[model samples]
Target: MASHSSSKIAIYGAIGANVAIAISKFVAAFFTGSSAMLSEGIHSLVDSGNGLLILFGVHQAEKPADARYPFGRSKELYFWSLIVAILVFSVGGGMSFYEGVEHLKHPAPITDPTWNYVVLGLSLVFEGISFFLAFREFNKSRGDAGFWATLGRSKDPSVFAILMEDLAALLGLVIALGGVYFGHMLDNPYFDGGASICIGLLLVSVAIFLIYKTKGLLVGQGVEEETLDALEALARQQRGVEQVRRPLTMYLGPQDVVLALDVEFHDHLSAIEVEKTVDELQDTIRANHPEFKRIFIEAKGLSGKQRNPLAPDPTSPQI
Candidate 1:
């Protein structure tokens, strides 16, 4: 819960920064007639909107489970994150690419670049602050894995979406700076358009990556290896349990997981004993993994037909 709260903090910070930067970039772009500058403005504006959507999603995700939705609205976060990816592609990437093509066809000289430089510099600073905040929040839960691995494993989409948007913004600013400088240096306006195209491509790539990542979380994904292991070990500790099958786990949200286990209790155990053992096992599991909102344990033989998530080896890492 604390980590989720931190993600909201990071998101709120990014929203403020992007809104300020977008307004400045639009003013400068209007004055300078720089294609790259316009693209940057659009990028910031899209990011600002995305931040709002994420906040809304986060709120909706927290809605308590009701008759209509038994598992609650936790997946709403994933749905909104997917929309963020779509927005980046359609608004940021599409607009920039279209502007780039138009500018390349009939390039126009940029007016006084002084304002452009000033705005770009300020944007870089704002984006840097936002990026740092996101990275700090993300780094808190990243463990020892590399950044890319952490991104892939992260269940929270709000933090990562902001991180990627800020990352793209920073890189886009650098490209915009180069384009503006060189367009004036060589008396060629097409360089500005080329930079816009590059920024568009960058946004496209970031959007695609976000889509891929969010899809897994939205559809449902397995719990981490350590978490599954702990649950499995807890089940085995129960008396009269001869064997435990691979536990099936699904993430309903970052903090909510549904777990199911197929266990074969010893044939010698009485019905009352089996019931007693089951209750103890559940208590132990809930104590160890508070994330398990629902746990279903069935008494069934391991016929080798039902695949075990922990199969192949008892100690191997889960996917």
Candidate 2:
């Protein structure tokens, strides 16, 4: 997971690059009448819009917890990320696929490809810069983890979204360049349309992958199993804790987690002792795992029974 500030830097870089590339690619597409170039233009435009949506999500997710949203609005980032993926699939991929099919039906040879090459070159440069920035930020978060593992475990969507989009943009630019070069060389426009279709498929694949990743976060994914195990172990070390059941945890944001621990204490402990133990355990856990913003302990007697159901301990806080 990346800090919000790091995520913003990557997204802002992508937005700036995509906005410029989209304009130039559209101009080139209009002049050359190349299907692939047009598809690349649409891709850049969609990426630019996605970056803006991600920024909006980050802003909304930053809201403090209130009466209406006790967990804060951190998951708003996930919701907007889902929306961005849908837009990429429906608008970017669908439009490109439709345009490719239409172009294949009536193949139009490029009259002049100089502008196409120029735009593609510049687009590649800009997209590369964006990709580099995003990859760098992501690397900081991933640490020693492998790419696929890090991606699967990552909670922040903004960094990965921009990284994937920029990578796709770079690949799309290559395809468009190949289409323009070969279409002109072989005098076959079908190749250009085929390239557009390839780009469309690429965008769709990326969108689906993103949707799968974001869906888990939107639906309240928990912290890793290892984290839960470590937390349980820490709780078991408390002075009065007899048994620490497995802890339950969920991520509220990239860095926010809510944890619930069920612990069985010895029957001999007094209410005051229980309160002191709970407070000490919470401090220890917080010191170790700062991301666990909310911690609730369910103090249990021997054999998973509450110490007393008739009246709760006044000094012991549940949250």
Candidate 3:
């Protein structure tokens, strides 16, 4: 995931593009009476609103940890992301399906498709720009991974959320274009209605995926595997650490991680030595993985500890 500032650029760019496109599409839908265009308008409007909602989430998430809510409001982003998914699915997708079915029932003749074409063409350009911006920012966190992998592993939802919205908008525009053109050619408004329904289904799928990811993050996802490995290595490198237990990690936010570790010290280490080793291990881990906002280490060996399945014992005990 990109930093908070970089994510904001993507969000703001999408908001500007979507707002302008929504207005134009609404105007065209009004003048042309095209069901496809109407659905497209709703899609863009919802996208714009979702961008605003993400911005609000960012603001709420940045609030410092307080006495009442000690972990900070970082999960606010996850909560609002869930809200965005629900809105996109229910309002944008459901409304599109409704309008499409209604048009299919009535089969009202589309008055003029010229305005629909114009609006769709402009929308394609603006949405493409937004998508490119989002994709670029998203790629920063992806590294050598494929697009699908990057999307699945993305910690920050705002970037991928905008990416999916823009992609859906572009596809919806194409479907709308085909519906308008073919409806005029074959003189069948059913084609337009069918296209709208297809667009709605597309949006529903995207919303479902977003809902799944956001909900997972809200429920407390963990740090990357590489980071976890690094934590274990750091524990083993400590001066008096005899064995390293499994290092547990969970995210409080996109960039915030809470880590818990249990380490077994040397069999006969003094209390002072144990304390020194614990402090040094913490400092090293923090220096290596700054994402760990809170780190807790427990000396499990002499504290009447139970043998943990996850810990690895060294062949020979050191210091």
Candidate 4:
């Protein structure tokens, strides 16, 4: 709950910063007729939209588990973040590329200089502030992990998504300012067009990367290797469990996992004792791995055969 609240606040800050940057870029584009500035404006607009989507996702993901959805609504975070990435690629990158191509075909002269640079400078400052907040939150969650590791392993997708977007925004701002500055230096509108194309390409690349990671989560990817190892170790240490036959674990959402384990237990335990041991093992495993919200355990003897007389066939051939 606290994490979700903090993410909402961070996203709100990002939205405010992007709004200011969008306005500044729009004004600069109008004053100088710079394609790069215009492209950046569109990028900021997309970022603002994505921030709102993330905020909504944060709210929805906090809902408690219900009958129809017993796993709660955490996966909504990934679903919404994926949509944001697709929008950035389509609306932000695609439009920027189209505008750049148009400018290349029909170049326009940029008249003003001072106001354009002023707006670009202000945009950099605003985006920098937003990036700082996102970085602070991400670092708090990351602890000793490197930045790339945090990006890959963080349970809160919103913070990581915001971090990537903010980084891309900062780079886009630099590219836009450079395009204008260099275009003026060389007296060539082509420089502005080229810079716009580069910015679009960068945004597209980032969006694609985000989509790839989010898609994996949405498709029920397995838990991290470290998490799986932890679960395995806990299972092996439990009494009456001789060995772990197979352990299957998958992430239902951020910080949530569903685990299925096949274990070999001592053959001497009676039915009631076996049930009690299994229950105790479940409690122990859950206490050890808090991330596993759903657990299924199958217990068998050392020979890989069930000890209970009424146990289902282990290898029943289907017709």
Q: lDDT-based ranking, best first? A: 2, 1, 3, 4
Give candidate 2 regions above 4 Å deviation: 308-319
- Where is model 1 poorest over a 10-residue stretch in terms of lDDT? 308-317
Across residues 63-139, which tens digit of lDDT does each residue of candidate 1 receive? 88887887688889989999999999999999999999999998998868899999999999989999999999989
Runs in model 3 with CA error above 4 Å?
A: 302-319
Give the alpha carbon lDDT tens digit for every residue of 93-112 in model 4: 89998888999999986777
Q: Roughly what TM-score does model 4 have, to 2 decimal places?
A: 0.90
- For TM-score, candidate 1 versus 2, the one ahead is 2
Q: Output the lDDT of residue 251, model 3.
A: 76
* Model 1 stretches astray by more than 4 angstroms: 224-230, 301-319
Clashing pairs in 1: none
Cα deviation of 173, candidate 4, in Å: 0.6
The residue-by-residue lDDT of candidate 3 on 1-319, one tens digit each, is 3488899999999999999999999999899899999999999999999999999999898888767777788899899999999999999999999999999999987877889989999999999999999998898888889999889888787788989998999999999999999998899899999999999999999999999999888887887788778888888888767777678877778877778888887667776777767777766776777677777777756455633323112311111
CA lDDT scores, all candidates in order: 0.86, 0.87, 0.85, 0.82
Model 1's lDDT to the true fold? 0.86
Worst 10 residues of 2 by lDDT: 310-319
Q: Give the runs in model 4 whose Cα sits over 4 Å from its true position.
A: 271-273, 303-319
Candidate 4, residue 124: CA error in Å? 1.2
Of candidate 4, the 10-residue stretch with the lowest lDDT total is 310-319
